[model samples]
Target: MTPTTIRHACIAALACAAMSASAHGLKPMSDDELSEVSGQALLSLTNQTYDGLDFTRITLGADIQLSANLSKVRLGEYSYTARNGTGADIDMGLFRFGRSDGTEAQRTVNITDPYFEFVYKNAADASKREVIGMRLGFGSIAGDLGVQLNAISGSLLINGGAAGNYDSHNDPLGGKRWDGTTCTSTCGLTLSQIGQLTAGDASGASRDFFISVLRQAVNFPGVNAATGAPDKALEGFWMNWRDRLYAPVLNAAPPPNLPKPPG
Candidate 1:
């Protein structure tokens, strides 16, 4: 082919291509059409069914650092058996997580993939459906925790008590820490009454921490307040979501307990 003819043909082809591209620039999809499309997101939601229950789980794909403090906290106040007839499932004067420092990373609790799971019973039948339980959880966590328990219904277990750690100065019932020498007369309580508590997991990683509040009343076996006998009492159900809780010393002493519960 001649050079002139080849050049002319190339110019015509380029013009045709530009015209076709302009004719089909872009078009917006309608709402109906867009609904058919699928996409991925940083957060995912899923529904699962197992054992006659339905669960909706929301998972996040990110890390979080949190430093929180609650001066006065109360949950499930319906009974009048605990804390000298205070009638609370869990009541605390102070609750704190993590620590504050000049650096933000150092001051915050490290958490990964925070999630919320909602559980329902008879989900398919709305008339008979009910929310059985819901929970907020972390895939993993590493942080510091401090708490001042004024009143509680469930039992708490702490490890390693070597006397001098528990006393009855703040207790109204004239409680005393048991010393071997005092076995002749006065009975004293130990720092930990529920025995040693295990925290974290077998792999030594602190993971799967969650707090669950159930609709049903769960029985917590504990010493009877009136008879001091081993008995199980039904109270609002609550689940713990921490590694371990250290006992705070009373009376504002060195290494004192968290601030007192708000009146």
Candidate 2:
């Protein structure tokens, strides 16, 4: 063929290839396709795990349209429950991860919701740090140590041994003393006992303090006390802080107010 003719042929072929690509949408690399290219099918690729029994795969026809409804059908999973005496199918596409061989991986997509979200950036975010510091200050004041003067007095007095007195008479700044009882005998009370005696001051005040500190550090608005839990607005902040700080500390610390619950 002449040079001009060959150039025209190449242009037409390129256009056809582009149109084909656009029409099919991008086909994600399935296990087989991934194995072919990468030489291994990496299960749990999304750093998530699931029981193998929960997942099933259905192949899709090449001609299926790329609309949302069609995509949902392609990713749907069947559900059966004995209790309901009914079988229902759920859209598996709602699940961002899927399992094969009991291992889960994130769906290959441009956007996905991570099962565990971590915000490393918030750690260095200056505004977050300032907010957290302020929150911690409030938390400290409202906490057991700050609110329960009796507990503080008890702890201090008991630690002071024979010198323990409530009068604060002879020694102005010195520890208080109890005239009827000597604290030296009972001074060895466990930390849990101390916590219990102070518990009435604020139910989960210590925990709230820690949570507040974290919220301030990450620039999260205050938590809703009425909800008895962190609010949804703090979800992202909590997710990030928990992964980075809270989880690790809780794992390391002895159970809060521990020594086992009273029988």
Candidate 3:
């Protein structure tokens, strides 16, 4: 064919490819691999052992879409539930998902309806305000110290995008800078006892700080549906929307009663 003719043919092919891409959608590697009814995530509390109570798993799947062109997986109306039917109900709350599995990509992961409930084993003090994401406050996002994304080459199954190099970890409990890591102890406390600890503080305040969300990463290691291999993790994740949350108010009289500083 003549050079002009060949050029025209290439242009047509490129246009066709682009159109096809827009018409189709991409899903996570796990979604493509597993034939289960819904997306699932497994946690090995004792290291790859599920026959015991230490192992926990949850269901994670929704209208998840993937885009190879953007190198991102966007969760559209996604919500994760407890596989055992007695765990937290979590969901991603945002759309513009960026890559979080690289050295320098902006990972802006927003959360919604997040929860966490685990036994606080061996805590030295119980009267102090417990916090998560850090015990000393302020460090690198590379470590699983608090509520952050899974590291590259790790199997944490962050159901979002492939990954870039941006660290965006704004913990709901702590804020942008925090280090007080402590989970509310629920291991041996009865229902009534647990209430005593968090309900009526020494100053007569209530447990309205938050509903206590379990900031966890839905990890599905061992088998991935995408590469058909055991890739430590599926990179990072991102939601496709946002919503407002509501709760009953407490301590409404604080501002009115507190001493006014010198104007």
Candidate 1, residues 59-94, lDDT tens digits: the string is: 896888766776777776664443433455556666
Model 3 spans with C-alpha error above 4 angstroms: 1-54, 65-220, 223-263
Which tens-of-lDDT digit does each residue in 1-263 have in candidate 3? Answer: 99999999999999999988976866456764665656434322212431121222222322222211111212212235312111112221111222333222223222222222221222357554322210110000111001121111111112111221111122232111111122112111111111000111133212111111223322222221322322111112211111011111221111111122457
What ranges in model 2 sit over 4 Å off? Answer: 1-8, 13-228, 231-263
**Candidate 3: lDDT over CA atoms?**
0.22
- List the candidate numbers ranked by lDDT, top first: 1, 2, 3
Worst 10 residues of 3 by lDDT: 136-145
Residue pairs in clash, model 2: 52-102, 131-216, 132-216, 132-217, 164-176, 164-177, 164-178, 165-176, 165-177, 166-177
- Which candidate leads the pack in TM-score? 1
Candidate 2 least-lDDT 10 residues? 242-251
Tens-place lDDT per residue, model 2, 197-247, is 111122322222222112222333222243243222121111111101111
Count clashes in each candidate, considering only residues at least 3 apart in sequence or on different chains. Answer: 2, 10, 29
Alpha-carbon shift of residue 217 in model 1 (angstroms):
6.0
Candidate scoring better on TM-score of 1 and 3: 1
For candidate 1, the lDDT comes to 0.49
TM-score against truth, every candidate: 0.51, 0.15, 0.16
- Candidate 3 lDDT at 219 equals 21
